[model samples]
Target: MIMRQGQQLLLPANPLFIWFSLIVAMMLNMLPVGRIPWMPDFLAVVIVFWSVHQPLRVGVVAAFLFGLAIDVHQASLLGQHALAYTTLSFFAITIHRRLLWFTVPSQALQVLPLFVAAHAIEIAIRMLAGGSYPGPTLLLAPVLEAALWPVVSVLLLLPQRRAPDPDENRPL
Candidate 1:
């Protein structure tokens, strides 16, 4: 089980990067993609990523607040996103340490159930409200989000990844 030099690279955690990533994800969620309401929930994805990596810094409270903001921003059922995100963050925080041991793609597989749980929360909320189901297409959002997890993981991890030692001998 020998690891390569750069494989275990880890850099200091930057709060700025964490907050900025969350804000950016929120903005992306609000982007106008008219008529297509099935856009993946960027906020959820980012929250999952941060919650898993920085659970102490980004916990259930942050997820709740962000979910509220999202609720207000989208003008949807207040607290719906909040509840979903809260639940999602809780699960992420709980399993974060275990997740870190796996590769990004494997991590995504582990998160699939959490994504499904979050979506189920949303559906439950709608059902309780007597709202019509958005159909099976609604379920696709979680799948799409899970698929994008690898990309999100890599992009977020890029800044924190250590560069190869410049003094190391070059292949000759």
Candidate 2:
């Protein structure tokens, strides 16, 4: 993979860090605050982030499992989030290489559609299962998630950005 000029090379992501971030995201989603219609899905954002950045380690299965956890937590349709997240991960993985070629903000713009599709899948499944419209504010969820892309990218990539061994004579 040819990196963009000026792009710092990131170290291999630790498996433990990957799973830890996923758990933290899940915990954030499980918070007691009522599920507001416009609130972004933190787990979805993290899942997509990892799927794009480390597809082999965090793929559709992880997304599906996390989605199921969220489904149970929210007491919504069993497969609603599972299917949505699975689709999101699949798409992110498919485009991961191409997506990495762009700047972070440009990548965010590219991923906006993926977020929209994920939320649309969730809403569609809900409506099919006889749930009422969650109102127009529901549209904000995907937009918010896309807006969070850069922040998520920076924070998650932080650990890998550090020098494995800092030495005055070496620059990496």
Q: What value of lDDT does candidate 2 attain over all alpha carbons?
A: 0.94
Deviating ranges (above 4 Å) for candidate 1 = 1-6, 35-37, 164-166, 169-172
Q: What is candidate 2's lDDT per residue for 81-105, written digit by digit as tens?
A: 9999999999999999999998999
Question: By how many angstroms RMSD does model 2 differ from the true structure?
Answer: 0.8
Candidate 2 pairs with clashing backbones: none
* Candidate 2 Cα misplacement greater than 4 A, ranges: none
TM-score of 1: 0.89
* TM-score between model 2 and native: 0.98
